[model samples]
Target: MGIRHSSAGKMIWLLALASLIHVSSLEAATAETVKQKPPRLNIVFIFVDDQGYYDLGCYGATEVETPRIDTLAQNGVRFTDYYAAAPICSPSRTGLLTGCYPRRTGNEVWVHRPDSGTGIPPSQTTLAELFKSEGYATACIGKWHLGFSEPYLPANQGFDHYFGILHNLDSYEVAHFEDQGGVPLLRNGEVVDRNVDPGKLIKLYTEEAIGWIEERVASRHETGSSEPFFLYLPHTMLHEPLGVSPKFDGSSNWGLYGDVIQELDFYTGRLVDALERLGIADETLVMYVSDNGRGPGRNQQQPIRGSKLTTFEGGLRVPCIAYGPGIREGHESTVVAHAMDWYPTLASLAGISIPKELVLDGRDLSALLLGETDTIPEFNQKVSLNAEVPLRREFHQDLEWERIFTRQEYLNAFFYHGSHGALAAVRSGKWKLALNPSLTLYDLEKDPGESHPLNSWEIKTKLRGMAIRFQREMIEQGNSN
Candidate 1:
């Protein structure tokens, strides 16, 4: 009996010893993983005003030279089917910064002029706010057309620093309204220059951005801090009444427009080179996108119909390039992407935790950007819209403007066209239902220009149902609120 008990005790001791050894090994492995984890990446978002889909050399612009932008595409991923959230400027920028449709934020029509009282509300959280909250240095250097009011400015919206015009350069001399003569160039909410030269604005903006970047880097090195940065550089080039510096006045065969684009490219190159020199190129995510499509008789947005102010492909589709570390070189993604997607995409890339309470219309593109997946997961779903999901109204604010959508509206791939505060059309996948002038159905894949209309009952039914459901839900949600 004693001998049997001794044998059992020995076996128990051996098992206990093995378990401890396994636990110790796990602890060691976990510590190593924690130590080797990469630091959060910096982000540089370059937003240009009114650049067309084919404006960049890589996107098939034979007339204008965009060597730097072309190099950016060659070094990273270029998106062919990328689109601006709105067909015009103000709403497009609102979507980009907030990750919500322009209508949702109450700015749908054209851009805000100096006389406009309304602007992006203070209640909405911007991209700069998100980065700032995460301890990242934030700056906005260039055009800020959202608002010129005290509360609507970039500084109030979360930028640590802001240097640019309140509205378009044309606002300088050409008065859009009485008492709104010139656009005042500001720095951190103070009017720095009221009569700034339009030709020198681009160069000035570039220099300011570079100086900020250099100072930020130097300060970080001096302090031995590892804090990342978020730079939102929105250029005013290519907008109507385009002007270029003396050095690049007649540089392109395609005329003044091409000259402006080339100079834009040169400044872009300078910025990228600065990053490389600072040895942060591999630790940063650089993206280039246009605020909206170009105007008529400007840069080419060929094979797509309609221009700025219209809800056609030419007005919505714009060039998008993603460069820097982890992005596959020379890769082209035809996946459907929007300007709003950048809000969530950048958050994911920088390892920032997105607020769970926030209703985001953007999808995380980290998998696609990292080359892990060819397409976004949402696109793979059989049924895009899930109406069964409960709609949540977390933040309620009473404003002068009406709300466009609830959280439920973002569940589907449906895009609402509200260029002038009225629903002109609704798009779901390849089908577009036009409600203006006349009821028409178009298959964008077959007729990108919306030149041909398809007579299909099935498509019309599907699209009509989506539009009806969206409107119904919006009304119901609004009443409940």
Candidate 2:
């Protein structure tokens, strides 16, 4: 009887030892997995106004210093061929928020009135809404040009808080409105009693943003649940009738425009530093991009010829920088992308699903950001509108509508023919044809600056066909209807 008892005790001891070993191995594995996982990234979108490709220090700009923006590029991916859906403000901003083409959304022009239905349609879902649904807090500060109505403001468009101008401004130094009807700043929906001073608009935006961040962090700490936040900071910097803060006046070697750019850089530095100080630097994503190109007319002070109205490269290609966790640093992406992409990209970052109805013109660049997209997809794009033909012999000719019959017709005749009425373009591979019943073909690979035209009938016809197909698609997709 004693021998049998001893044998059973020995077996029990062996099983107990195995269980202890298993628990230790499981704990070690759990610790290893936690260490390997990347931190959750918070997003901060810093959008500047009328900034150009050569506007930043990293993009070959020698005129003004953009050291802070440069540091962002050093730590993140810089897009070389990034584009805005439109070459203007209101429309492009609409595209950025909704991830849909502005033309499709019926916001093909700028909105200048408070009652104008020119803002983002209430029916449409914005990035903020999508993020908010998934437990992220969102705020939009500076330049809400969509519409000034209660239903059209930032809060209604998915933002928890909105602060900024109601429309485009000719002078950033003047009052936005004559009375209470057009207060420049608001929280949620009520206008702040202290009107936003035009000269200090940039500083105000930065200060408000920092405040928002601190509030969010505190709220998370109190709730014991950290809900990530999205900060959309769009500044009216480098825009015409330039307004500079008193400290930045005469601070730049380049005049008013230069001074404004310097001011922009300074504020951008402050925003980034605030995040770092709050201990959210590595987890926060900072994206610096321009809404569109500069003015179409020639800059008497600079080398570029064109201002906000022209269809040239100077009026289309803008500056864009994306920086954050897990992103490849200092790498440049040549992928043809637009502002509309931000919607889906931000959605993906927040682990939210984009709406099915919101057809996006731009793709999620996550692969590009993670160093996975080696081969870029061909960008076959076109900008189409009814153009007025110039009288063969006169400059002040009557306006007449000519339906650009085919892409071939448009490209064979109209690229770079920016007269007055309308213009369109078709870019495929290295060939880009900007047309308006006047053919202007450009090999972007060779002439990245669009300084010379190829002037070949074969290339023109091929691109024109591509443009026609694009136009047809646009109409069929209900984008032009």
Candidate 3:
């Protein structure tokens, strides 16, 4: 909620100052008083593949140095309790792009494979489409993994330009090579590289992203337009077939995976440098988050339990950092925010209204991001804002924030779904109820590992009821499949 400074607006001031500098002080004052439309913020979201919560230095990483990403975190709002939409790739991406739970979109359960006939339904509105509708230039670079077919491709999903592989890099390995050809690098759905080397993917995707950004800036200058842009750069590394550029091979003390992580840090720096080079750093809002959490290989995801594919804290919670103009620097927020919330938060930032037909599980987080609110609304409420003309809430509980956000996620009952799309747990505030094992409850604040159990029949019954109500609502909407 600070100053929305656009590069174009800054340029306008510079030119105005150049002409008015020779004039009297009164005339020069006009340059400062001039009114110009601040360009809508350009968005560059760098979504990682299988990064653990403690994978980056900012998140307590030690084996691998992630200076670039760490710096971004140091100078931005780092969310300690940030959660991805799902524990796996496709469902996670689906939740992020569509602003709905993967189940709501019927894309939950598993990653979309090459043979999967369907993808994100055309009826669903993606983040790209939402930004594009507001006239922002949209592009999707790096791993797509949504679908390889026509209607499901990035081009049809509202990205003006699409680059990189349509699916995962694992398909190109020796085991699956016979059935699935090497992941072909594509440009607007046309194969550019027949066999994309996973080792060079970081550099290639980095170059593509930087070049595309440079082109967009050049186009803006040439066309004399201030159209903002959106770039979804989902890197392909840190998942499987760990890749690294030649320069970074064996660069870390942690071996191949560390090398890959270092390479990622380097390329991420390149992207940030490109933005600064084009004088659009302040005009851009950059976000770094993982699509899902990984096993506690080198970095234990510390304090969190379980790993990817499971419905544990480690599987859901991951590192998230937001930087750029209008955001407070060097802030670590304990407030719980999920990937799904980005959809509505970005809409509010860009000043666009969602189409009324859509039903989003994500709440608008503009207030939280702007430091206006510390806690989210009730479980049933859709956003951080008061709904009615005055305000109205349907929940019966302690709604006051009390300047504490450690238990914010519990305010909104979060149901955890495993990789296979089975309901495993329900979390409300500080307590979590694991469904399958006779409805055992755990105080997550004290036991993030989900180790200790509290034998309380009342709490368990209430949590179980919450789960039942959630499923009922989901089925009522016909999205419980």
Report lDDT (CA) for all predictions. 0.72, 0.64, 0.75
Task: Please give, for residues 322-395, the per-residue lDDT of candidate 1 as tens digits.
Answer: 98666666789977778877886677566565675666566666557756568763322121121111223233
Question: Cα deviation of 117 in candidate 2 (Å)?
Answer: 2.6
Per-residue lDDT tens digits of candidate 3, residues 1-89? 12234645445533432232212332445544545435567899999999888888898878889988888877768998788888999
- TM-score order, best first, reads 3, 1, 2
Which candidate order results from sorting by lDDT in descending order?
3, 1, 2
Candidate 2 lands at a TM-score of: 0.79
Model 2: per-residue Cα lDDT over 249-284, one tens digit each: 897667878788888888888888887677666567
Candidate RMSDs in order = 12.1, 13.9, 7.2
lDDT for model 2, please. Answer: 0.64
Model 1 regions more than 4 Å off: 1-30, 171-182, 295-301, 379-416
Q: What is the lDDT of residue 460 in candidate 3?
A: 81
Candidate with more favorable, higher lDDT: 1 or 3? 3
